[model samples]
Target chain A: MSITEIIIISLIKIVIVLGITLITVAYLVYFERKIAAWAQNRIGPNRVGWQGILQPFADVFKLLLKEDIVPERANRIVHAIAPMIALFVAFTTYAVIPIGPNVNIFGYDISLVVADVNMGVLYVLALTSLGVYAITFAGWSSGSKYSLLGGIRSSAQMISYEISMGFSIGGVLLLAESLRPIDIVNSQTNLWNAIVQPIGFITFVVSAFAETNRLPFDLPEAEPELVGGFHTEYSSMKFAGFFLAEYANMVIASAMIVTLYLGGWHLPFEQSLGLSGIWLTVAQIASFFVKMGAMLFFFIWVRWSIPRFRYDQLMNLGWKVMFPLSLINIIWVAAIIMIFN
Target chain B: MSQTSNSLKKRKKDLTFWQKIYIPEIAKGLALTFKNMVRPKFTMEYPEEKFIPPPSYRGRPVLVLEETGEERCVACGLCSRVCPALAIEVQAAETEREKERYPEKFEINMLRCIFCGLCEEVCPEEAIVMSKDYELAFTNREDAIYGKDKLLTPVSQLEDRIEFLRKYK
Candidate 1:
């Protein structure tokens, strides 16, 4: 392929990924409200448009119209850049995730993923780790004690959880014997990694929740304590950036979980269906999205179901429970590989 | 050798292996929420679909206007005095009707009214009863001080509450 062709294809892929992600992020917020209301047996946002379908757009408009207030004592540059960095990290991590296998369109082989890097998994982990800076910067720049505390807590929490997360991923890497996401997905042909390494899966899922700063693990932005957390001084579309980034991060996390553990895009016994090449590819892609949707639903469901963990409890779980558990998972995976192979 | 009584000791049992894992417990919680997701939602879509409060439901206090277009209040000053928040203001005037005294100017400052049901309970002539008018939105303070027009509800409308007060009170 020519350089122009490559650029065009890359541009197209980027647009497709970003477009889907933004739309999903918007609807995720809408569904989060709906699901929360359902759990509490109350009607959520239904007045905006046809059962509050346009609520996300309405929220964006409201945020855009609001006054962008920066605190007098705040570091204006850092405060402004924090959410942008978050948005960048959250969105960029999706570039390497293979939503579906390679497909041939118009006799040209087109990979569903944008950038199929050799170290795709590492890229995702590194980018997600960079997300810590966004929160920490927001906290420090806000010039509020609340924001600073939130930032500090998040940094500590993210660092603690990332250890378990990294170790958990170590098990998957052992099985796949590759750092690439596509290879990881391909390795889990019949039995998923989730079934094989249940402990690792559980630890990874828990750590993902913590990494995303979701409920139960959301000590950094514990609303009652931190009073809006790191984004206390943020207003207008800047705040919306963080909001968008958070939901986008959820989408990416769900996708990663799907790709890593849930057998991304490849349905069990799908090969025996005797379908055409195009149709099979389509089915696989659809399968990937379906799994992602389910994972996202689980995320929202768990959020509403479980109350936030205390700071001490969170630390204890990370260190005493998750860390040791993940380490044990590595041993378990090693044992299975040695015995079976 | 002192013998310790086992009966008086507090049992501090450790968590079992399964409980220590916590997955089963978390699964139980997830299942509970999942079940609730499909259950009959008790959401009353307000404004579009107004909630019909039960007969016992105490809403805004309203003056009962009989079919004769005359209020049931005889300006006894009982309801005004009984209002804990001092929300009611009644000025009695001489009338040609069988009830010689009638409230020429009756007002209830809903801002002050605590919806305590005291005025409804203390009504001597069954004049003032709480009606199912919970939507009390006012733009300003003056609008919130409900006058005779705003406070008065037809006897037909307040029938459920009046009957309920009679049955229970």
Candidate 2:
């Protein structure tokens, strides 16, 4: 494809992906509420639309109409930039995720992915690490002691977990023998890495929770104590940006899980399913979504079922426990691979 | 010997750097939490699933009547006088033919009633008592101010007591 053609295709893909992500994020909130209500034997949002499915849209409308307030003493530039950075980094990670294989579009062959980089895993890791900057900036720029403390705590928590996260991915990289996500899936032709690298899988799952600031590890934004945490000063679209980033991060994390461990888009024993055309690509995209939805549900389940951890306990878990276990897992995996080879 | 003993006391068994790392403990904690997340939640579904109130629970106040269709209260005004919260108000009227005292009007401001059950305890003839109607919610102030007719129990339930009172007299 020519430069212009590639640019046009990329823009189109971006628009489609972003539109779907925004809509999905809205529904994910509604889904979370419904699941929570079901678990608690209460009626969740049912008045807005059919079974309250439109409730998240209604919420978005309300948030958009609400006043955007900036504190007088706050650093306005950083305050505005923080959530955008978070949201941008989150959305950017989706570029390399292969929803499906190649297909013929208007007599031209096109891949479903936006960018198929050799360092897809590293790119995702980089984007996820950058997500902390937004939180930290929001906290420090707010000029409030609470926001500052929250930012510091969030950065510390994320950094601690990131180490273990890197180690977990190291195991997957070793098993796959390639840093490219597509290659990783291709490597898992016989069985998913999840079966072989159970310990690494556990580490990755737990680290993902901490990295995204989900419940149990969601102490940085603990409402009762921090009073809105790092984004306490943000309002209107800026606040919504942070909200979008959170849900988007959740989506990205789910995608990573599907890609890394669940054998991304590779259905087992499907050598003759005739999924080579557009239909195959569509099915792959659908499978990716199903896997993501399951992971997202698991995220919500953990959130509603458990209480937030204390800051000390969270730090203890990340540094003292998860870090060492990941290291041990790495060693174990290396030993096994060596012995088998 | 003294120096050796001091050294021994000072050389406390500090956790090895590896033990201090806490990876296994966190794994255990994660397992426990994950197990809890999958476990069945204990939830109480309200409305359709009602909770059984305790036996001694005091609810709304109701008035009692005699079998001869006479109000059980003889207008002694004891319930009104003894009520610490002064929630109950009673007025007496002399019957034209019998020249006997009967309550002309009875009103209980539930808004003011502290639900101490003092009025029911103080009723000399057991004429007033609290009933098991705790689902008492009102949209208006007027609705909350329960008067004589609304405060009284159904006539069918009071009929037996009223008949017994008439037979004894």
Best by TM-score: 1
TM-score of 2: 0.80
Candidate 2, residue B7: how far the Cα is off, in Å: 23
Q: Which candidate achieves the best DockQ against the true structure?
A: 1
Please list the Cα RMSD from the true structure of every candidate, rounded to 1 decimal place. 3.4, 5.9
Model 1, range B1-169, lDDT digits (tens) per residue? 1234443242223566677677888899999998988888897776688888899888899899999998889999998999989999999999676889889999999899999999889888999998887888988998899889988888998888888988999
Cα-based TM-score, every candidate: 0.92, 0.80
Writing each residue's lDDT as its tens digit, candidate 2 over B21-62 gives 445655565466556545665554566677655435567777
CA shift of B48, model 1, Å: 2.2
What would the per-residue lDDT of candidate 1 be over residues A1-341, giving only the tens digit for each residue? 99999899999999999999999999999999999998888768998999999999999999999999999999999999999999999999999999898888877789899999999999999999999999999999999999999999999999999999999999999999999889999999888999999999999999999999999888888899999899888899999999999999999999999998999888989878998878888899999999999999999999988999999889999999999999999999999999998
Regions more than 4 Å wrong, model 1:
B1-12, B95-98, B149-152
Indicate which candidate wins on lDDT.
1
Compared with the true structure, what per-residue lDDT tens digits does model 2 show for residues A1-341?
89999999888888888888888888988887877776565657777978787899888888899899989889999988998899989889999887766777887777778887999999999989999999999999999988898899999999999999999999889988888888988887678878888888888999999999989788778889999899888888889999889988988888899889888887766567766566766777787788889899888877876678888888888888889989988898899799999
Candidate 1 residue-wise lDDT at A140? 99
Clashing pairs in model 2?
Answer: A320-B21, A320-B22, A321-B22, A321-B23, B66-B162, B67-B162, B67-B163
lDDT agreement of model 2 with the native: 0.82
